[model samples]
Target: MTPRAKTPRNSGQRGGHVLRRMRASTVYLLLSIGALVSIAPYLMTLNAAFKPQSTLLSTQAWTPAVPATWSNFTALWSQYDMSGFIVHTAVVAGTITLGQLVFTTFAAYAFARLDFPGREPLFWGFIAMMMVPQIVTLIPLFLIMSHLNLIDTYRALILPYVFGTPYGIFLVRQYFQTIPADLEAAARIDGAGTWTILRRIMIPLSKPILATLATITFVNTWNSLLWPLMATSSERDEVVTVGIAALQGQFASELHILLPAAAVALLPLVAIFLLFQRHIVRSIALTGLK
Candidate 1:
């Protein structure tokens, strides 16, 4: 029996498949290169963090930290009161994150679920705040804090931001709008109050977006430098960013110490990202879908 002849159609389809595969490979290659480019600085910083001051100047920037020393970390912890700065940063970041979650959830819920006169106008007006840069409000915030005699206190750090940010409110509100009204109606039919429905139904269902918002708030607050620097003068109230900047001043010529201090400041954010990465991705997808 004669074998079947290859047709032009079959050959054309095979060529199309090869072209698609080539395109995909090119895309992947470009993406991988971009990822490496983005991460190169972090890699260099990590290498520098463990190198000695002498080695840092002599070795290439990309060189791995061989025979890594612990002295940089030791000096940071022992001499610089790194523990106190870490604790203060943690306290401020944790408080801001918690406050944003609670306040933003409630505000978003009200905007998303409830009907009132001028509600849309009010929400849009509030969200317009997002268009305003923090620098615009910086001087006023400082003056207010100073007038209230809260400068250098945790209150100065936490109180101003605890009321919920415009971005947080907008994000949660968008997520809340995606939920079906039937859920709330069913809860109401069962005599569940607004607070009960929000606590039991909305909050649980919106955990992914909430986690994303919390992680964002935590990282932003932890890395905050300008506000903390302006508000607090003493070491006792300073956060990790301020502490790291101070390390730069004290060890002006020591890249090894400065890099380690910066790396240490980054650890908590890295841990948080690793823990909540899935939720963050989900939240991003949800936002895009909405």
Candidate 2:
């Protein structure tokens, strides 16, 4: 059979497809370039982490660490007491994450499910707190901590954060609101209380969002510098971010040591993201839909 004639309409359709493909290719090319630009520093840091101070200082920034040594990692672990910093960071980040998850779960459940006087107004007011920059509350928080004589204490780090955050509440609440009311109704028919319904139904169903909130809280708490710096006076109580800064000061000229220390500080966050990335993406999509 003869092939169909190349009609003007078919030609136009083919041309439109070509144009669309070209636009997509251009978009992808730009995105790839942007990704490489963003990742270049981290690549440099990874390379620098393994080199000796002499080599790093002598070589260009982009050069890979030839004959890579574990010395930087060793020094960071031992001389810098990175273990202590890691432990402190873990404690603070873990506690804050747990607290935010628990408290925010309940708060979100309440706002989404329970009937209360002025609930909408209260929730809106709480969300309004998100609009206020955290720096605005720094002075008041410092004064309160000072009044309680909690400065330089773990209480100072953990206590202030454990109550829950506005963003966490909002994210979880949005997810919770998406949950079917029928589930709660069925649970109630089975004599389930608010806490039980939350635990067995809402929390379980909202895993993706909770994971997202937990990951965010953990990363933020772990990377926290300004607050931890002000709250804790001594090196013993400082988190990894502050510890890394102090480590830089001690090894001011040592790129090898500083980069490795920064890399070490980054490991937990990297691991957390790799582990929960699916949930994080799902949560974002879910939140957007809601």
Candidate 3:
């Protein structure tokens, strides 16, 4: 009988370990570069907001101010109606976010779980609405508002959008479908009705997707410009987006003020993302699995 020789294991193991490390390092490096590229413009905007006019016009506009100045912000809040615009923006965004949450949650639950006449057709019809360019509806919406004498009012600003959006409904409906139907069946066996199942079972389970939808609604409503401009003629009712646009036109020569207003307008969305980033990431991962 002859014995066979075993191959050496050290080189192969060390080479594979080293290869894994190299791949991980490459991934991290690429992600860091991508993050920097995405954030650079925001950094420049915030930096320029604090820079003096002299520095803003210079070639080194991206450089951080030596000692950051608050004059631009002060001027915007005092000389213009920036503060009021911010308040207006917050109210509208908050209202729309809340409305979408309530309406979308119920609507999605029904579409996902309930069986009704024309259910499939109605759901697809809503999907079809998403493809219709929003601008085409603007004229009809305006005419309705005008006839109702709601122009330049908060209702005019909020009414059209406070209803659930097709995207919101779709997002929530898909997420709801991902839930285990067994949970609802068990709850029903224990004397739970539709509302009980929704309030206790579904709502808690849907938090991540709801948070994602809320953040999106708030940001989109805050950033809406065209509808606000067309719906509200009064400066007192102006949103930050519309206000910033007006400032850009009027203060075209004043980069200092314009930059500060623009930077300040971004703070709410940044705060929302920072606070809910975990939920957003988790929901996106869960939804991706769908």
Cα lDDT, all candidates:
0.90, 0.89, 0.92
Per-residue lDDT of 1-290 in model 3, one digit per residue for the tens? 79898888798999999999999999999999999999999888988899877777884767778778888888888778888999999999999999999999999999999999999999999999999997999999999999999999999999998889999999999999999999999999999999999999999999999999999999999989889989998887889999998889899999888999989898888999999999999998999934
Pairs that clash in candidate 1: none
Q: How many steric overlaps are in each model, in order? A: 0, 0, 0
Residue 158 lDDT, candidate 2, scale 0-100: 97
> lDDT-based ranking, best first?
3, 1, 2
* Candidate order by decreasing TM-score: 3, 1, 2
* Location of the lowest summed lDDT over 10 successive residues in candidate 1: 72-81
After superposition on all C-alphas, the RMSD of every candidate to the true structure, in Å, is: 2.2, 2.8, 2.3
Poorest 10 consecutive residues of model 3 by lDDT? 52-61
- Give lDDT: candidate 1, residue 176: 95
- For candidate 2, what is the lDDT? 0.89
- Kindly list the per-residue Cα lDDT of model 2 for residues 1-290, writing each as its tens digit: 99988768688889999999999999999999999999888888888889987788889879878889998898777677888999999999999999999999989989999999999999999999999987888889999999999999899999988979998898889899898899899999999998898889988889999899999999999988888988988987988988888887888887777888888888788899999999988988877844
Provide TM-scores for the models. Answer: 0.94, 0.91, 0.95
Cα deviation in Å at residue 250, candidate 2?
2.2
lDDT of 1 by residue, 1-290 (tens): 99998778688889999999999999999999999999898878888889887788999989988989888788667767888999999999999999999999999999999999999999999989999998898899999999999999999999989889999999999999899999999999999999999999999999999999999899999989889999999998999888888888888886766788888887888899999999989988877834
The number of the candidate with the highest lDDT is 3
> Which is the leading candidate under TM-score?
3
